[model samples]
Target: MLPINFYGKPTIGGVIGFLFLFTAFMRKKTYTKKTKGLFIKQRPEKKCFKCQGFGIIRCDLCSGKGFVFYERKYQRSDPCPKCFQKRYDMCPFCQGNGERSFLGKTGSNKYNKKIFRIFE
Candidate 1:
C-alpha cells in the first residue's frame, strides 16, 4: 500500500483527492428559477452632483496649484502628495467613480408618490 503523504508529492489516493477537489471547484453553480429573480434590480446611475461627473475635485491642501512651497518660498516647493500633483482629489461624495444611484422612486408613479406615505 502506498503511504499517504498529504504534504509531499501526491500518491494515487492524493491525486484522486486533488482531482475531486479540482472538479468540485471548477463545477458551475446553478440557481433555481425563483432564486434567479430574487436579486434586487440595480437603480439607474446619475452624475454625482458634488463632482459633476469629473471623479475628482480641487485638492484642498494645494488649493489646485499641484504643489506648495515649504514656507511660501518660491525657491523650495513640494509636489502635492495628496493629489499626486494632479491638482485634484478623488471626490469624497462619489469616491471617484463619478456617478451615484438616482435616489427616490422611478417610473410613472414617481411624480404621484407622496413624500410621507404615512400621511396618505
Candidate 2:
C-alpha cells in the first residue's frame, strides 16, 4: 500500500480515496431534463482607463527619463527609480493588459432559471 501525502502530491491511496469521494459526490448531483448549461456571453472590451490602453504610463520617479543618476559628480545613468530599468512599467490598474471587461446579467437559461430567480 502506498503512503498518503496530503499536502504536496497524490499517492496511490490518495487517488483511490479521491476517486471514491468524487464518485460519492457525483452520485448526489441531480440533473433535470429541462436543464440547460450556463452560457458565457462575450462582453465588449474597453480600453484600460488607467493606461488609456497604452499598456504603460509615465514613470513618476524618473519623470519618464527611464533612468536616474546616483551622484551629480559621478555623472552616471542608472535604472529609473520607479520603473527599475524600463522607461515604463505595466499599468498598475489594468496590469498591462490594456483592456477591461465585466460580467453582466442577461436573462438566465433553462438550467439557471432557479438560480437567477433568487437574484430577482
Candidate 3:
C-alpha cells in the first residue's frame, strides 16, 4: 500500500490546479461563421400613393390635428366633431407599412428518402 503522504503531494495538487485552469482558459476561445442565411436581403423602399408618404391623413373633422377647443356655454369631453376620432387613415390593403406578398413554399430534399419507407 502507498503512504497517504504520497497521494497528498504538492505536485499532484499543482497538476490538478493547472488542468482546471487550462480548461477554463481554453473555454474562453470562441468560433464564428458568416452564414449565407445570415445575410438577409432588405426589401427596397416603395412610396405609398394612398397616404402620400405622410403615413396618415388629416382627420376629416379636425383636419388631422386631433383637437379643436371651442368655448360657448356647455362643456364637453368628446373628441373633435370634424375628425371624429382616428387622425390617420391606414392603407386598406397593406394596413399602412405598405409591403404585401404571400410567402411561397421553401422546398427541402431531406424528406425525399422517408417517402418510400412510408409507402412500403
Candidate 4:
C-alpha cells in the first residue's frame, strides 16, 4: 500500500495514464456521406457554338433542300448523298447533344456568345 500523499505530488505513472485517457476520449473519426446511385464526377458543360443547342444543322451538300438540282439532265433533282434526304445532319461539334463539356472556365467564355460558322 502507498500513502495518499507521497511527497505531496502525483506520481509520473498517474499523470501519464490520465493524459492517455484524455487524448483517447478527445479523438474524433470522420466519415463520408452516402448517396444513392453510382458516383459520377460532374464537369462544366456549355452549349455548342455550331449547333446553337438545336443539335442539328443544315446539310452542306443539299443546302437544307434535301435534294440537288442539276441542269445537265434537263434540270433533274436527286437526293443528297450526305444527308440522305433528311435536310439536316447531326452537328459534329456537339455530337448531336448540343452541349460540350470542359474541365474548367479557361476559354469557356468565348463559347457563351453564340458564334455559328457559315458554310457556302
List the candidates ranked by lDDT, beginning with the highest.
Answer: 1, 4, 2, 3
The models' CA-based lDDT, in order, is 0.67, 0.64, 0.50, 0.66
- What TM-score does each of the candidates earn? 0.41, 0.38, 0.28, 0.45
Which stretches of model 4 miss by more than 4 angstroms? 1-45, 101-120
Per-residue lDDT of 1-120 in model 3, one digit per residue for the tens? 222254556476666777777798888433333467574333225544555433344555566666665667975455776556666555443344444422211133345346546778
Q: Best to worst by TM-score, what's the order?
A: 4, 1, 2, 3
lDDT of 1 by residue, 9-100 (tens): 76888678777888889976432234456843222257778777666789999999999768554478889889889898887766666676
Against the true structure, whose lDDT is highest?
1
- For candidate 1, what is the TM-score? 0.41
Give the backbone clash total of model 2. Answer: 0
Per-residue lDDT, model 4, residue 119, is 21
Error of 1 at 32 (Å): 36
Question: Candidate 3 clashing pairs?
Answer: 58-64, 59-64, 61-82, 61-83, 62-83
Q: Worst lDDT window (10 residues) for model 1? A: 103-112
lDDT of 4: 0.66
